[model samples]
Target: MFNESKKAMTAISQYCGNRVDYVQGGGGNTSYKFNDKLMAIKASGYTLADVQPEQGYVTVDYSKISRKYDEISKKMDIDVEAETLLINLDCVELLHGMKDLRPSVEVGFHSYLQKAVIHTHSVYSNLLCCSDEGRDNAKSIFENSKYGYIYIPFISPGYTLSIRVKDEVIAYKAENGKMPDLIFMESHGMIASNDDYETAIEIHETANQMMIDYFNSVEFPKAIIKKTSKGFSSKTEMINKFIVDFSADENYFDTVNIYPDQIVYLQNNLGKTILIDKDNASIEYIMSEKQAQTLEEVLLGVVYIITEIKRNELSLKLLCKEGEDFIRNWESEKYRASLVND
Candidate 1:
């Protein structure tokens, strides 16, 4: 069972992992359900590109997780995060022997989805999802497409997010007679789930392209990062221009933030990764090459989303203060960031 899932995880990771625009750092989770009882998902703090056919994922009793969601839904005043984490821990298949690994915090929602699920914090999706009219624009963008779509407003990640998504998915299935293939979460990102790996990838690609075409948006500008003795520096025209313009504003990144990954990778740590020398109009990274690269991608992505949103005259939909705080304190996100920053 793990064999088939491992193959599928590797395939999907190879397909999207290295695409910086699709995911930066360890910001995405991919999963494959081997059957009704067991499913394999990416481990916490690991980048998709880091996944191989034989490693980088863990198998869990998804059926148990799905059942637990149903049980929790009936109860009142439950500690959603604590309850969900314990449930996921209990459902882990110890026989497989990845004991130290933790399933993605999103396991609850994945358990109820199709066999193959790819969730990405894609910049293309954020162009629409990070705008005030995101849901309405999404409806019009994918309106005539073959895939069924659902929109979830911004919410807390982990158990709270998963439960909300579960409700929406269940309601969608009831009315449409099938689960939705495309899910667009406001101030979050997009999810493409299907019965197989190829179709899931297809749905994700097609939907992102649809959003791109809808906005008549150009491709993101190249992020030119050059290594230096101290670390790395940004040479891209767009990025340097952004730095020159917004360097004076200390909270600029937080203001332009369009999604959770922006918070996790940029805003929270501030100048730890990329150092902005406002006096000289220079930006330098003081972290590892991989961490520097991740910061560069995220920095450029945030700038790109802001540019496109402003060009289209759509009101920016920044992550709320509550949302920002939640992500700031999330243990799972901290672990993921630690891996990149280490």
Candidate 2:
């Protein structure tokens, strides 16, 4: 029954995976819904680039998720007891071919979306999401956009964001007469979903193009580099606080926590880069001098992105404690990280 789905999904995954401009650090998830009963989602820590139609995804009973969210949604918006509310369900794995394989943490939102959904953390999308006028700019294009669009404020990927998306989707449909084809998540990524696989990919491409064009139409302040303490350089003072001299023995990145993708890429090369460690990561470093230099460039990119984030005065998403937990404990991501380009 899902033969076409497998073919479609495989085609789209491979198509998008091959583009580093779209799926970096395996930080995206794609899924194809097979009836309300099931969906095959890209497994956690797995790159869409490496996904084979039959071997990579975890089949999940998405209907079960909808039911659970419906029940929880009623009281979820209640602010008073939000902290005390308890809603727990057993580990529901109706069919995960590989026992250890977990679907993307984003599965919750995908289940609430269309039959086909592609979510990617493209740098182009971030140009709008992270710019000072990004939301306004994106909203302007969406106003005249050929496709129906929905914009979500920055909410990290989790049940909370999923529930929010579900609610917004319902509201959008009620007002616009159809579900959104393009859902732009602030400071995160964009989701392109449709009943047709090819259209989903098309919409993602189109939306990103719109964003790229929008950014091109506007001028951005260049990231100016100035000498800083301990042989570091940056455009922002807050971010510069974490960087220090390259150390042969100490992990300087330990004192700071950066974005999710940065954590993944810099894990092994912490020591060699002009260190700007944060969040007291305290993880061990294992990269050689060359690896450290390469990672330094990545960190510099991070610093520039972060500077833009601050310059926009946008509260872009950053990896929190929970996100840090996943990068450290998840073995699958560790392997993916070993190969992911920044």
Best by TM-score: 1
On the 0 to 100 scale, the lDDT of residue 41 in model 1 is: 86
**CA lDDT of each prediction against the hidden true structure:** 0.82, 0.63
Per-candidate TM vs. native? 0.92, 0.68
- List residue ranges in candidate 1 displaced over 4 A: 73-78, 94-99, 245-250, 278-280
Q: Where does the lowest 10-residue lDDT sum fall in candidate 2?
A: 80-89
Regions more than 4 Å wrong, model 2: 73-100, 217-259, 263-269, 272-342
lDDT of 2 by residue, 14-76 (tens): 878856556654678898887767788887657787678666677777887767666665654
Q: Pairing residues by index, what is the TM-score of model 2?
A: 0.68
Look at candidate 1 and tell me the lDDT of residue 92. 85
Angstrom error of the Cα, residue 338, model 1: value is 1.8
